[model samples]
Target chain A: MQLQYDIEGGNFTKAGFASSEIKKVLKQLNVDAATIKRIVVSSYEAEVNIVAHAYKGAVTVVIDHEKIVMQYQDEGPGIPDIEQAMVAGYSTASPEVREMGFGAGMGLPNIHKNADDLLIESEVNKGTLVTITIYLKQEGGQ
Target chain B: MQITELAKLTEAQVRCGNGLMHTEILYAAASDLMSDVLTIHHDGMVLLTGLANMQTIRTAEMSDIHCVVLLRNKKATPEMVELAAEHNIILLESPFTMFKACGVLFNAGVQSVY
Candidate 1:
């Protein structure tokens, strides 16, 4: 199954709708609870990043019996230094955004932790693309 | 611990999900940063956060958290309450600060995810 969603930047209230839907879909697909939790949390953090930093974005999720792949592409001020952005305490967000209890610089690192494979490509002023992949079933194992 | 008992320990008011007061809570996480909260996965967990916003509640929903206790006397917005109710998550408000509320709950045997 493939699912797509458009995300509005700076809209905290609507931020998690995509993640919630992904969780429900995974649940209905009989994905293990632990796996679903990982996917949902990763997706939530990614979704929040776009809402916190981008003007707008889109998420595409593809699910097969063996794995799930999620791509988050946003049109906004993209990361200048992907390496620095991955640091646990590096953030460029404003004080207002930080006051909302985000932009602690833990987002990308946390997403990396939960995802089996994480890919990020960005431009300085154009946009960013973050792809997260997780195995729905163990590789070479029952 | 029962959510009601945790509320009592923290001197909290149930802003919503009153029917969920009977829900049993096994673990607690206290943080204003929803990113950190989402990183931990625990069964029967309740989030104790000072951040009173829609995103915090959404964090709870994504993490499959059963309850959210807003500390430091922070009020839950109407939208937050409505969303929590929709998600069947117990929403609470405590007059105590994050440290005090967490200390109280910890003293009462509510384990932390860390």
Candidate 2:
């Protein structure tokens, strides 16, 4: 199955909608609970990153029998230093965004920790693309 | 601990999920940062935070945290309440500060999600 969602910049209210919807889909598919948790964490962080940083973005989720892939592409002030942004305590969020208890610079790292494979691509003046993949089959699968 | 017991310990008022008051909670963590909350991997945890925004509810929802205790008398907005209800998350408001709230729950035998 495939799903897509549009993310609006500066819209914190609707930030987790996509993650929540995809979580429902995963649950309906009877995906492993642990796998679903990891996917939700990574996807929700990516979703919040777009709402917190990008001008506009979309999340595409492709679920197959063996794995799930999620791609988030956003148009905004792309990261000049992806490595720096990956650091846990580095962030460029506005003060207002910080007041919301986010912008602690943990989003990227959280995504990295939860995703089985993660790829981030960006341009200084353009946008960022983040792709994350999670294998559905666990080592102890039934 | 039961959600009702935690509420009693903190003198919190149930904002929603009254039916879930009897749900068992194995651990508790207090943080104003939703990012820190996301790092927690424990299921059936209660989040004690001063940040009563929609993101708090959303973070708990994503983390499978079923209960939240708002500190310093912080009240959740209608949007947050609605979202919590949708996610079947219990929201409680307490007059205690974050430290006091967590301390109280800990003293009452709620394990910390460390």
- Compute DockQ for each candidate against the true complex: 0.79, 0.87
Runs in model 1 deviating more than 4 A are: A137-142
- Give a tens-digit lDDT track for model 1, residues B57-76: 89899889989989888999
lDDT of 2 by residue, B1-114 (tens): 999999999999999999989999989998999988888899879999999899999999999999999999898899999999999999999999988887787888889876
lDDT of 2 at A94: 90
Worst 10 residues of 1 chain A by lDDT: A133-142
User: Which residue pairs clash within candidate 1?
Assistant: none
TM-score of chain B of each: 0.97, 0.97
Q: What lDDT does the true structure give each of the candidates? A: 0.90, 0.92
Per-model TM-score versus the true fold? 0.94, 0.97
Residue lDDT tens for model 1, A1-142? 9999999998877989999899888878888778888899999999999999999999999998789999999999999999999999899988877877888899999999999999999997899999999999442334
Regions more than 4 Å wrong, model 2: A138-140
Report the number of the highest-TM-score candidate: 2
